[model samples]
Target: MEKYTHLGVYGVLVRDDHILLIQKARGPHKGKWDLPGGSIEFGEEPELTLQREFIEETGLAPITGNIRTAVSYTIIYQYDVNQMEELHHIGIIYDVELLDDQAVLRTDGDGQDSLGAKWIPLETLGLLPLTPFVEMIMEPAVQEESDVGMGTEVEG
Candidate 1:
């Protein structure tokens, strides 16, 4: 067995009670919902990685991206028929805002990892197969109000 570390930059784009997410086309998270981002290229800045990945995965450009937080998770899986590995995934998350709120999302494969992008309601997050990174960030936000009950939601 072997162990390796993979670091990636991701964005959290939220608007009108919905969150932007990319459907994974491959890798350990294949077919699961993930953040719109990927590994940093050699000699590339983390911010650049976030920007490039967002465009690559969502086909939409972000106007502003600010560092929000970092999170990590570990998974054990078979990388090959004869190889098993422990993968530690470290994610650098950013709070991103789009240039145009109504910009259409890319729903076609990016010829790499993403299948497409979609704006999913926060409340429906639990209904999808999400990557660990998505679960880590969303758990707190979604569960924060669970004990209070939705019927108590105050009208704005």
Candidate 2:
């Protein structure tokens, strides 16, 4: 068996009580909901990767603010029927505000990885099949904000 480690940066775009999510069109989590992000290109900074990916997946440029490393985990994905690779995913969840809240779902530009983007109510996330990392980080991210009594407020 061969193993591979994949490093990805993700954004947690929250507005009101809804979070922006993309429906995966390919890869291990195809057909599942996932954060707006992807694997970082070689020599690309994680922050840049987050920015690029957010736009690519959502079709809206993210007004990024305080970015923090949210969570890291390793999972085995069987890309082929008999081939499993260890994916070490490092998620850098950014506080992002969209330039246009009314931006409709787009598959143009670099948004091919996802079928489309939608704002889903945070509470109803469980109803969707979310990527493992998104599922793992959602609770703590929400809890952390609630704990501070600071709801979604994007800086700049």
Pairs clashing within candidate 1: none
Best by TM-score: 1
RMSD (Cα, Å) for all candidates, in order, is 2.7, 4.7
Candidate 2 regions with alpha-carbon error over 4 angstroms: 100-111, 141-156
Residues 25-91, model 2: lDDT tens digits: 8887889998888888999988888778876777776456467556777777787887877767667
Q: Which window of 10 residues has the lowest lDDT sum in candidate 1?
A: 147-156
lDDT at 28, model 2: 73
In model 1, which regions exceed 4 Å deviation? 144-156
The Cα local distance difference test for each model comes to: 0.88, 0.76
Model 2 per-residue lDDT at 11: 81
